[model samples]
Target: MTDATTRGFIGQLAQGDRQALLSEGVEQIFPARSALCAQGEIGTRVMLILRGTAKVGRTLSDGSHTVLGLCGPGDIVGEASAVAGEGSARLAAVIAVDSVTCRVLAASRFRQVLRARPEIYRTLVAVTNDRLRRTADNGVRQAAHPVACRTARMLKELAARYGRPAPQGLLIGLALSQHDLALLVGASRESVVRALSRLRTSGIITTSRRKIIIRDPDGLGRAGEHH
Candidate 1:
């Protein structure tokens, strides 16, 4: 799992452990906007991302989709269902945000690896716990904070995790639309647009072609604080 607070699973593994895990899988490439995995389907394999980014989300009963998290290089997807034994339904859908390369492993093989490598299993458990905690925290923040505050906090997080230094400011490497941000923040697209406009007008951030540049990180942090 990839998140602002937690490093991806492959990055956390020892070099030997990492190599061992990758050796079991076959490399596959997915194009941008492709579905890596679908929710509610039986999971047969898990994917370890080697390059690019993916978005995890679940569709609601009312036909709306909620963004769960973002996955980048070194992250693993569909592991939860793979770990849940045979015929386990996937809890979320993962789609390629950009061209993605992954090492794909069958569920049985993954389980076999876990049985042989207790250390790896422990590490996966830790990562899962961290993801769950972050999800819970986001839920609480959504209920307690204003949309603008939450949006700012999310931007700061993206910058901290995936940002690269640019001439203008810290550029978030992920290509995200206003609707994607809205889904991630659990707000209406209109509300997210207003929040982003405010950030732009105040000279805290700038956006062009789905790329966001944080001009004043400290100012963004201040804006994220509860008002």
Candidate 2:
């Protein structure tokens, strides 16, 4: 199954298995804001998200924060830490973006499952590789491209991810606040505002409240072109 199907179907299978597993060590947690991995915690655990979102960020010198990325439902967190033992939490914190439903899989059982079903392991590797590639590509874009270009590119990517066909074209459901938009585009909130207004004036996009309607998909695509 692809990312879309894998995320959609597995949630439906063995409807009761998730609940049963939740009670036996492989439990669920709806952590409050700013939840760091517990001290002296075992590294052999997997977090399967059922809903909501979290920020994976590492602390920096001088007390500033740099977000590694945002993760949501169907994402598996704790992989890096789970893989590398005898280390402090590699990630500084996993803060709840909203209330989240998650199942914890014991590290040992996770490995056993993988050993028994090597095919799943192969798929996991492929998924991880693709994600890593995208992350590297995004970092390069942030470093090399102008914010206007990056913002346009990110909008198109998000549209493809969450968009549905509409008479107007693709309706991107990204209701990102200025700060959030800035984070993705690597721009100041003021720059985001200016770029968005300029795009609107140019007939490339239309924004209503938080929703963005792409009036000219090709134009928007060009605006976000990396090269």
Candidate 3:
């Protein structure tokens, strides 16, 4: 068995499993903000992200949305619908947060791949469990943590998962708006603004034009510990 990683589906598979999976899909590129899948729509395929990040979320009846998670390189999307059988509807929407490249396999082909490799079934179970675990953790943080702590923890999480070196500091790869950040942390937009301002004032982070740079990741992490 391969080591577990946030890289998602294909990442859990061994070389042989990976190759066999790739053989079933065609690569496609999507620009930032493109919707890869939308809630309530019948899924016809599954996507394996090869590069960049995608946001997974569901739209509410009030026109608001909740961000469930982010998907980056090696993550798979739409698998649940595929596993439910063809013509199954999506439970959420997945949109590219940056320019993305992905391998898309038609539903019929994906089902075939599942049956052909029993090992893949095991891998699928593992990946699905990891995703569920993350969702549970996020819920706990939102319900129990204060907004400042939640915001700080969110920065730490993003930096750990997607940070890239920059002259200024470690740039978080996602270009998240304050509203989007609010959605992720389950805080009000005003509260998120205040939290970010506090972080900036403390010299733990800096933000500009939708980009957030972590100036002191250690400090930011510590902030998350506060009630």
Candidate 4:
């Protein structure tokens, strides 16, 4: 399979299986800043993102929120809890970062489909394992890296996953505030702002409003490695 085909839940599916899965769910639109799934709630359904972006995160014991990851088109959210069976609490919150379209399936029905399609189920398991591995890597980076290095690595990741070619550089498709970056990298907002400023000053990136463009990806990568 191509890299794209193996990356996300929907992408991993065969054409017929993709259509069959979507046919079993209802389409729903979630507005920006709304919660698609809240942490700690007993999840009843899973959502397959059809368009736009969402932030997957959780509130800590001290009531501070940390961003776990970002999900965009073709990604699946809430499947872990949904597959864990009826009474399992959601492990994270999925909030719409922009207006998002999703295919929503009841947990029970989702499980039924999985049971009937072993291949699809296996693909889902692989996707889940990949996510877990990335999460663990992010944890290790947070513990070892400086804010600037972590910020550079995070921007590199975002650019690879969601960037599009533009006149200036690769424009990150997702709109993100500095606060979002801070939460994602486990740094203070002020520290993230400083890191961004350093990157901007170095001509490695440019930002306007909530948009960011990578002007010098090679330089950014070097910064991530050196610091």
By lDDT, who's the top model here?
Answer: 1
Off by over 4 Å in 1: 1-7
Q: Report the number of backbone clashes for model 1.
A: 0
Clashing residue pairs found in predicted model 2: 44-107
List, residue by residue over 4-116, the lDDT tens digit for candidate 2.
Answer: 22342233334344333333344466664645343235565667665655666666777777666555555666655665544435455666655666767766666665565
Worst 10 residues of 2 by lDDT: 1-10
* Candidate no. 4 TM-score: 0.89
TM-score versus the correct structure, for each prediction: 0.89, 0.72, 0.84, 0.89
| Candidate 3, 6-45: lDDT as tens digits | 3457766887888888777798998999999999999898
Clashes of 2: 1
lDDT of 3 at 128: 90
Better candidate by TM-score, 3 or 4:
4
TM-score between candidate 2 and the true structure: 0.72
Could you tell me the lDDT of residue 83 within candidate 1? 94
Please report how far candidate 2 places residue 27 from its true position, in Å.
Answer: 6.2
Query: Which digits, one per residue and each the tens of the lDDT, describe model 1 over residues 2-75?
Result: 43123479877876777789898798999999999999999999999887789999999999877899887777
lDDT of 4: 0.87
What is the lDDT of every predicted structure here? Answer: 0.88, 0.63, 0.85, 0.87
Off by over 4 Å in 2: 1-44, 85-88, 162-175, 200-217
